[model samples]
Target: MEKDKIIKYGSLTLVAIFILSTLSLLFLNSNPSVNPNNSVLQGYVIGYAKISSYDKVVKVQNPTKELEKLLEDLSKNGTIVRSFNFENELVIELKDEKDVYRLNKLFNEYNSSIFADAIIDFENLTFFDDSGKQLSIPNQRKKQKITPLFDIAEPFKIKADAIVGEVSSKEPVVYLLSISLLENEKIQIALKPKNITLISYAISLKIPWDSRSYIYDLSSKLNQSNITNKVNLANYLFFNSTPSNTSLSQLASSNIPFISKITKSTISLNNIQTKKDEINNLLSLYNINVIFPDSSIEIENLDTKNINFIEGLVSNYSNLNISIQKENLVEVEFYQESEYGSTKYVLDEDKLKVRFKTALNPNDIKNISVQAEVVGNKIKDYKIQQEQ
Candidate 1:
């Protein structure tokens, strides 16, 4: 009987061992086993979506083989792990992060490596995830989030001091200013006239002893809370002193107005007209003859916003006689050292001309001339010249 009991217990222990082994095997299978192929999903990137404008939902005739080969070549040392279709775009992934810049360059340089007839906007492409959500090229999709160095979200942060001067042998209080980017590839600049006020329009209001006389143009540029980087400034050349033109002078003259703080970022400048209606309304006042210097800047991308402010003045008090001069203004900037810092520009189209008309009268003429002078409340060691 004792021998039988020992044998029975040994048998029971063997059964228990078998059950434990079976359970272990099942657990291993249920849990995720390490797979070598899964590493491809780790640091992947989605290619920019290229879409058709006329037919937004038009699918590519042959997407997989031709497009796939081009993307693989663009990713440098990376490989195309997987791809799928989302709407009309071919969503693709690259296994390496180092290929981000390479892909961008390739997308721009060669729209299609194989198919010459393929038209693609490689910069802006759309793709969707498993959840049917939109997935754009990472980091670069939100262009606004990425601000180049010294770019202000609000342009008004730059101290915009007024350089009140006269045109070359021209009359009326002319605002002569020149703006340039100065090797900074992040910021944009513009100039638009706001209005003029007559403290004593002997010929034109004399640049008062108070440095605050330049406040009108300053406030117009740097007075917005959240400035949309769009400076739709029309020909700041006005012929009359109406509400828009006259009110600027009388608006804020005592001190330099404060504009809200701004953050910097880049944006597009297509289909934007600087001076549309404002120019038309003023056109009714006079036959405008404008001379735009044949100078243009070629931009790489639409990363910087375009802004414009007028660069002239208003005077109903007298026939003006003012002598103006020109400087090496192929590039210029009216930068003010405000509390924040100096404003930067990627490019500035800052050429200006000032002219006003009145019946010629010798006594009515005011003998005053101006040079490019930077005067404002924010400026130090400078004062507006008082009339003698």
Candidate 2:
């Protein structure tokens, strides 16, 4: 009986140890956030070329959108490794070469329809095989020669931005404000002008920020402008909230000026600040009252459940640097680069490090490029990167 009791106790101890080891392994292996390098298309690009052309390059639709739509029409089989503007054309890199063949077939089908405006110029489109040899598309259609609708002399330009988190919205969220507004007003909040149905609907929205435009972006601009005291931000920043509803619903409903929707022949990626912003912005447009992650409400305290959403929303864009502190704490830093300088913000969610550990993908946080930083949590320090 004594031997049996000792054996049973020892067996239970071993089982407990095994369970702890398994849990540790699972915790270590689980990825919390997206990896930055996952989006970087270094090699394995089968082909690259411009799919369409426009008379006015400035009016050229963002090729990313078109490419995404084209891929969707093909039943969403391909993963877009990378896309950027080269001269007048958009160069696309795909992981699978077979996907290119399927894409060509869909383009051929488009050529036969009235939607021929975006038909693939088969002769110009290039593809490759597994051996990295340029394989001529099989039974390729004759290159369609069509005159551009409008022609204007302007150098083709493009800016690359990174997408963080999953984007499920059908219509991308874009923030466009007049450049004059930034130059003139200390604080400007503008909305995108409604799409013009008469003209081409492929027009891309001109973005105001170099990297991204967050809803809290106004605060960063104000901090950089050195006019915080000059402008009455109290009226804009503080919003009335109900005891039951801890949100600034009245502020969100306030009329914001509609800036003209300016489009350039640029491919803006489906990059957004947060899923919360994307949802709330859509809700506001349709006169929907409810929202999540509203910034206007006062937070009496912080916890993992409450603060994780806040950190995730502000951590969008590319080239962020995250450091793990001594006690397994985390500090996430975001940077935005501009002609004038770079603005950086670092958020240390106080004793709530595990939230970031789960919210951020540890592999992609370090060694990433940060264009600017949001000083402290509110855009305090303004560092000017002098032009070389």
Candidate 3:
């Protein structure tokens, strides 16, 4: 009877351990709040080239109605990325590169009138034409410094020491990421312009999984002359929620009874773009979001639930349906890159990140942070144009 009791207790103990281990993988004590708007393209901005011809020659009779229209229109989607007005000529940088082409065409059509000649270039603040003709602006560039600051709760700051109790990105996930907005969290970054300013900025995020995949970016610009040169978190950081905590490979391995099926479903990519649309579609379907200035992808499905959707895609690359068997390696590494020290390890399934940057001429540019935080990256393109 004692032996039987011991055996029963031992069984119960084992079960308790198993439950705890599983709970560790599935839950967390806290989480960051996610904003649904533009989460995937967080901190992303459009790029455009400027066409130069007229300086302050043609003044805006009413700067409020006409010019402000462009600024207000920016809230929707398309907005001018860069622009400048000098005594010699007026140059405008647009968000979409497509707009640059269209404007250049218009410039040529009206070159004989007052435009002189419209030459399109990626750089802004350009003056001289190729033929040594001068389009001089009397006041070249008035320089000043605009430091953007923020107001937030404790641990966050205009300047502060390393925060305590907060986990580092490098830490492994013992529990599914917390989905709670930390209290006392808010952020602000800004540039106050006294006069006309050409702004270029890119926001960046450190992927909780890895640092090498940092090039993914979303760019934005400041085209307005005196409008505080600021962007709210809404301008750049966008996400509905955090990504999934478990990787496809991890889920497949843990859930599939057949090891072979799990192995087959985790095929690698020759080009990340090949399945861009499909992958992107899956991301949306699963409530995934893409946050930037540092490049990272996020997804929002719980484990084991969406394995079939991915498994089908892997088996048949050409078709919408199928599973894997092409490769023969029994012990293959699914994501070799993860072996390196990446912040986006397994626990980041619920992971999300966002970045912010600011570039203006004096065309010099870059981040301050907080919860619902705003960060910065200084833009260099406009500065390059100034030097040239």
Per-prediction backbone clash count: 22, 17, 46
Off by over 4 Å in 2: 1-101, 104-180, 188-210, 215-388
TM-score of 2: 0.16
**CA lDDT, every model vs. true structure:** 0.23, 0.25, 0.23
As for TM-score, the candidate ahead, 1 or 3, is: 1
Cα lDDT tens digits, model 3, 178-294, are 111111012112321111121211111112221111111112222333222333211221211122322111111212211111111112222333445665675477564422111
TM-scores, all models, native as reference: 0.15, 0.16, 0.15
Q: What is the C-alpha lDDT profile of model 1 across 268-289, one tens digit per residue?
A: 1122134333433442354432
Ranking by TM-score: 2, 1, 3
The sequence of per-residue lDDT tens digits that candidate 2 reaches over residues 72-153 is 5533453544444433444344444444444445444454111111111212222232344443422321122111111111
Candidate whose lDDT is highest: 2
Candidate 2: worst-modelled 10 consecutive residues by lDDT: 12-21
Of 1 and 2, the candidate ahead on lDDT is 2
Leading candidate by TM-score: 2
